[model samples]
Target: MDIKELQAERTGIFRDVYSNKIPKRVPVNLSLTLEFTAGFGNLNMAEAQWNLSLLEDAADKLCQTFYSDSCPFGGSMRYPSYYQTLQSQSFIMGSNGFIQHPEVVGMDVEDYDYLIEKPFDCIVERIIPRQY
Candidate 1:
């Protein structure tokens, strides 16, 4: 379904749930976003593929390498990105293998100069091999 249809369905389901009415169908919230991790630096198909694979592997194992500031039970359900730093305040791994820092990017950088001083840690140590 498209965005409009999805939005309408979500609104309807939310209203129904709030009103204690049984929804016609069960609502499943599959929220996903895109994350931009690593770049191949303008390489050919073969080289690009190699770099892309490496980035994907790095992103896949991000959660195991770093710990978020908040606990799982906390209100924050943030997921760490593949190219994120361990000290990042908030991060998420996008569906398209992109590492996103929505909170930081959306904030006023002038007010939050601390972010500039402490950028997220780029995990290059665990990246995939180009040969693969």
Candidate 2:
């Protein structure tokens, strides 16, 4: 089938499923991760997200290799440069180019009162400052 036909069929599947109707067949939805796409294209995870052209080429190759009714290009999920620039301890990239989220406790038990008193302020000032 042509591209338009393929799109329509995919949309129909989602539409029917969301409408609480049984589709002609099960919807085979797929989700890709940044690391997976980077490895698939032999690209640096950090660079892939920063460079749109690289991501586009990799995405094209990725879709060609993997058959999925629906898949969002994974590298768009995170921009390592942004996180790197921010010096974020929450999300860090390793030598292998994979971003890892380390376990971090932004608030202590003693801070619970402050957190409860000002939820948004606690999150933005206390928690987020600690994270980024």
Candidate 3:
């Protein structure tokens, strides 16, 4: 069934369960990334990301055969950028793939007064969204 049909079928069951009624089958949400979730099953990263239909086929077989109801969702992994400049710090990965913390370079601001008075455009360009 499609998502709408599935939702219509399961919504009443979920509402009853929320009201302390026993559900025929418990729900599960496996919030795992495509890469990390490959560890659980016999799927490779490419298979999980590039070929989602195949991944779902494999999941369906595994779930039905093993009586498993686990569902996995893709997660994101963001990598930090590198900056090597006079007024900026940088991070580098070693040959063994070990990353070192960022090292501080020269002072970015010489005077607090000038920095505080600088216009918005004069500030460093925003690369990432601000998180709460």
For model 1 the local lDDT of residue 108 reads 39
What range of 10 consecutive residues in model 1 has the weakest lDDT sum? 123-132
In model 1, state the lDDT of residue 105: 31
Cα lDDT tens digits, model 3, 13-66, are 667678998877775544555444444466665444444554565555444544
Instruction: Give the per-residue lDDT digits (tens) of candidate 1, residues 1-132.
Output: 996886687788867877999987666543222122232222232232234454444343442343432111111133443234454534445554333455443333352444455434211211111111
Candidate 3 Cα deviation (angstroms), residue 127: 3.5
Model 2, TM vs. native: 0.82
Candidate with the greatest lDDT versus the true structure: 2
Q: Rate the local accuracy (lDDT) of all candidates.
A: 0.40, 0.80, 0.46
Task: Please give the distance, in angstroms, between residue 123's alpha carbon in candidate 2 and its true position after superposition.
Answer: 2.8
Q: Pick the TM-score winner.
A: 2
The local lDDT score (0 to 100) that residue 64 gets in candidate 2 is: 84
Candidates ranked by lDDT: 2, 3, 1
Question: CA shift at 120, candidate 1, in angstroms?
Answer: 40
How much RMSD separates candidate 2 from the native structure? 2.2
Q: Quick one: how many clashes does candidate 3 have?
A: 0
- Comparing 2 with 3 on TM-score, the higher-scoring candidate is 2
Alpha carbon RMSD to native, model 3? 8.3
Evaluate candidate 1 by giving its C-alpha RMSD to the native, one decimal: 16.6
